[model samples]
Target: MIEQVTVTPIAPPPAVPRASTWAAELRATFTLAWPLVIAQLAQNALTTTDVIMTGWLGPEFLAAGTLASTFLMPFLVGGMGIVGAVAPLVAQARGARDIKAVRRVVRQGMWASIVIAALLVPILWQIKPIFAALGQNPDTTLMAEQYIQIGVWMLFPALAIIALRSLLSAFDSTRIILLITIGGVLFNALVNYALIFGNFGFPRLELRGSAVATVLTNLLMFGLMLTYVLRHRRFKRFNIMIRFWKPDWPRFREIFRIGTPIGLTVLSEVGLFTAAALLMGLLGTDEIAAHAVALQCASMAFMVPLGLGTAATVRVGVAYGRKDAEGVRKAGWTAFALGTGFMTLTCILFLTAGPLIVSWFLDPRSPANANALGLAATFLVVAGFFQIVDGAQVVAAHALRGLSDTKVPMIMAIIGYWFIGLPIAYVLGLVLDWRGVGIWLGLAAGLGIVAVVLVARFAMRKRLGLMAGLG
Candidate 1:
């Protein structure tokens, strides 16, 4: 079926000035970067809120929540990955001055996302059997089912918001996304507090309460975003409402093609960590705890580069749309430098403040905790060391994604993490008995290899758009 998009009466965006110099590229990239960073941080804050509040309900709740999350996590990310194709597609279209293409991409993205969300419901709702099949404790599985039953309601709205965010990012409209996310952070907190504690005479729901808050917040955020996009004067021209329910098989196909790999790439990275955590467990609880502390620290620090990667995606996508290779290179390098430079500073801080950072996560007063703290501090030093390479790889991978080169990059990540990184980690950490340090060293090596692979792929000018027709 042909994708049908009605043209809105709104005017197209003014052309972004050609980025000719490093400074110019930096300025342009950052103009979009800061908001994205804040948005990402705020988004992370939402997850942190859920984790923290649910923890207060006690370990059972925590475990249940964790299981529920683990079950839902891949779906959330994969949907985003699929929907993420919207940004580059929209960005490129905008660059090529094909406003109709922009509208079709967004519409199809929305259509595809809704379809995915609906399909997920029956599966998510009936996952207790799945948990049982996996040999989970029956009680924990039941608790997880209760939480997910409520939380499942949020998927459609969340996916819709993700799709909208992608569309707006391509159009250089991130501030609103940031604002809404900031508002969501506040709203989620308030709702979580009220429902979790039964504040202001509200019945205390505890675990169920957190899911309730998530459901409510997602609904509100999606509504706010959708309302704004439909009514915004500048965005109204995309004719988002025009042919809103129309089916566009070709465009949806492209979304899946571009997005499936993107989603799997992300899932692979998450799996990498899961593998890392499993390896840490082999060294004993202290080692595992210390590894967790180190990973938490590294994850927090990673937000900066992750944001820069998003900016890089937008910039590179736009450049490709304009057929400006020089612009692409400049944007890619500027993002690389900004991301790496900032991470380098963080690495210094991690190394110097290792003890202090460990203290923040682990209790230093207890004798038993001392071993964990020291191990964590050591891990932090390694974490610091890898931050630079991590930043480089994420930014480069995102840049390649902007050019619609995802399949090879996806394979590279799998090979880098699973094939190269995991075995080396097994040898160095297990066989060599290097413990946590050895595992981290392997992770660092893996990231460096993947970074090299992605960077090399980005250099091949011909591959950048050779498959645009495929997308």
Candidate 2:
């Protein structure tokens, strides 16, 4: 006796004035983006803090720390990319007022994170051999191995943070996320200084100490977030943890289906840069250090747009769930515009203060480190050239994800980063003898292609109307 369901379609309301609609979109987008921006910047500060402190320890130590992070971020971001599928799904469900759906998505996302963590832990433990195979110096490779071994446990908590962050962002609850991350920065600094140099009777563990600090910081963030979600007055009704141990195959399938492509998309992009870092290592310590420093600078600036991209996903996802095509278009375009405008400002800073900024990460007065400063400056100039496009592409990708559209973007990323980017990097940097500048240019070129393609895809989707739900 299966019941037949009859669905009634409701007409969308009258479209608002163009100026009024855009103004509202801009306000809503910023409201969501600011807290996220601060949170992301604070999060990036943890690594920047590590880079700064490690740089004081000297280039070999800096290179070791940078290399460990290089390997770590790709895995971390890619896994989080999967878990990040929770955000849009939860946002849509919440918009539709389906608490059961949100809970199911959250649980499955947690399960997936656990699986990713298990796989990543063994890889962390076995990284030394991988480092050697990649032609890294034996001394720094050993140092990096110690660092990763002590801190790999943080990976689980870090992944949880992303899941939690995604859920909270979907609900427009970003203030707590920002507060927790900002507090973690101060806490990280305290632990890093005390442990790294043995202040306040702590053991001077050097590079290993920073890893310990980072691990502790990651755990603290997860604990704080979890406690808030479980106990907060505003969230009592959600009861996200009501079903602590249960298997819902259908729900898990949904999560995996949407998340896998996202993870692949992130891997495609991160893989390109990770390969660049490895290639740079073969050049010399100075070259690797320069590449890392320049990358760090670009990454810090990137956090702004990245935050907006996340906001775009939430905004667009909610609109999609409510079947508001106009709102979807507004949200996507607002985020893209804001991201591009902000990157333009950062580009000016990079172009104007490129050398001075690069010098901050490496001691210009030190003879061995001076070469890194110069090369990093050149890389920053290239970074400036591509930032607008980079921001646009990230925003566009997230906007598409709002519609549960990841497969094509993933394919596009693979084509751009691997098929186009890496080959150009190798050709210009190695075969043509252009070195670091050539590698950066190749990266910029890849991003430009990706940005154009993604934006065009999104535009086409708009032309076809997004109000009609995508299958």
Most TM-score-accurate candidate: 2
**Residue 126 displacement (Å), model 2:** 1.8
lDDT of 1: 0.80
User: lDDT by residue for model 1 over 1-471, one digit each (tens)?
Assistant: 113244452356677678888899989999999898888888877876786676555445655666677677767777778888888788777777777788888999888789889988888887698777756667767888988989988889988887899888877789998999889989999999999899978998887889999998889889999988989987888887797888877888989988888888877776676567656645565675676567767877888889889889889888887778788888888998999999999999998999997776555776767887898899899888889989989899888888887887889998998898888888899899998889988888888898888877776645645434322
Question: What would the per-residue lDDT of candidate 2 be over residues 291-316, giving only the tens digit for each residue?
Answer: 98999999999999999999999998
Candidate 1 lowest-lDDT run of ten: 1-10
Weakest 10 consecutive residues of candidate 2 by summed lDDT: 1-10
Runs in model 2 deviating more than 4 A are 1-20, 462-467
Clashing pairs in 2: none
Q: After superposition, how far is residue 72 of candidate 1 from its true place, in Å?
A: 2.6
Residue 399 lDDT in candidate 2: 95
Q: What is the TM-score of each candidate against the true structure?
A: 0.86, 0.94
**Candidate 1 global Cα RMSD:** 4.0
Instruction: Report lDDT (CA) for all predictions.
Output: 0.80, 0.85
lDDT of model 2 at residue 118? Answer: 89
